[model samples]
Target: MCGKGQLVTDLESGEIACNKCGLVSSDRLQENRAEWRTFDSESNDRSRVGSPTSLAYHDMGLATVIGKANKDSSGRQLDPSMNSRIQRLRTWDFRTKAHSSTHRNLLHAFNELGRLKDKLSLSDAIMEKTAYVYRKAQEKRLVRGRSTSSILAAAIYAACREMQASRTLRDVANATNVKRKAISRSYRILVLELDIKVPLVDPMKCIAKIAN
Candidate 1:
């Protein structure tokens, strides 16, 4: 191994290697940086300094909230009339975000998804996939008369299956406090409506997941 101290890190592969020798020093590097992708020059400049937008959020995490501080651009306290107007603006801003029935449904479902994510220690990919599945269900009006929690749980299960993540329906049900039967029913509906082809679960991965 050439120890020329010329090291290169491949973010895609999460590996650190020596440039001269092509020897990988580390293979499991944890990437803690913000997930930023450049679609265009203008967008790249505008989005350089924030958490990446995500589908899990109802607004895709791009919506801004009016600050509660009753101050102006110069940090001066606003007049009573201006303060009152700002307050109204803030209230309407909050209401308009979830004004639609679909928005409200997504708000509730994503709240549950966040909770289950923490409880089950889900990966970001699985969470995004779950959100996508839930959104598709909503778009098809398949969520009518169904419990949001059950549907969200079913989405999580489907995402897990699709990603080969080794999580079971019972596990998702227990995490979401939804009945297994309900999740199963919802899962079937999602698959039928969305035409999602779920992959077969690997028993070895399941055993390893359970053991861990």
Candidate 2:
């Protein structure tokens, strides 16, 4: 006969037995020990926040600038949109504060930003990229059919519209030393080759962004 909390078993002829409580057979228990090895000691430390030597950083100011550019001008927080473009802008911004360079380069970027802003189509990120792109084009001698200044202006205008900056072609042209006609022509060429998009700006979005 089995008592409380005990097991009863029948033998060949019909005998009964009682077993100890809370007893587990060794064969019925599971082995659950696990071993882990550390790889951190063997791996190289590869943590970096920004490319301090990159030209993009020399143009945009820092990652924060690019991040701010992606935000609504009203400074309200929202879900981050256009992650790819934002990253590109962040890279450009880094060039501004991280790189070692001359005042001329800094001045050049600032003037470029002013022109970009005047266009009502260019975003801060697009402006920075356009300047960086122009510098690269100059180094590669790939410029064609227009003066470098005009080409740069056109690129800036194109970048602004592509990245939804809120600038116009005429405005960017007026801000540059290059003639408006040349800027126009270069703009057409860039549009044809780069397939840039022109986006609509809604004041409500800006307001909603600001009001919050």
Give the poorly placed runs of model 2, Cα more than 4 Å off: 1-124, 132-142, 200-212
Put down candidate 1 lDDT per residue, 1-212, tens digits, no spaces: 59886888643234679999899988744324555556687654433457666789998887898999999999999999999999999999999999999999999999888987778767777788899999999999988888998899999999888878777777888888999999999999999989999877678886876788
Please write out the lDDT profile of model 2 over residues 123-154, one tens digit for every residue. 33454557665555544444644455776677
Candidate 1's C-alpha runs over 4 A off are: 1-47
Question: TM per model?
Answer: 0.79, 0.38
Worst 10 residues of 2 by lDDT: 24-33
Give the true-structure RMSD of model 1: 6.2
Task: Return the clash pairs for model 1, or none.
Answer: none
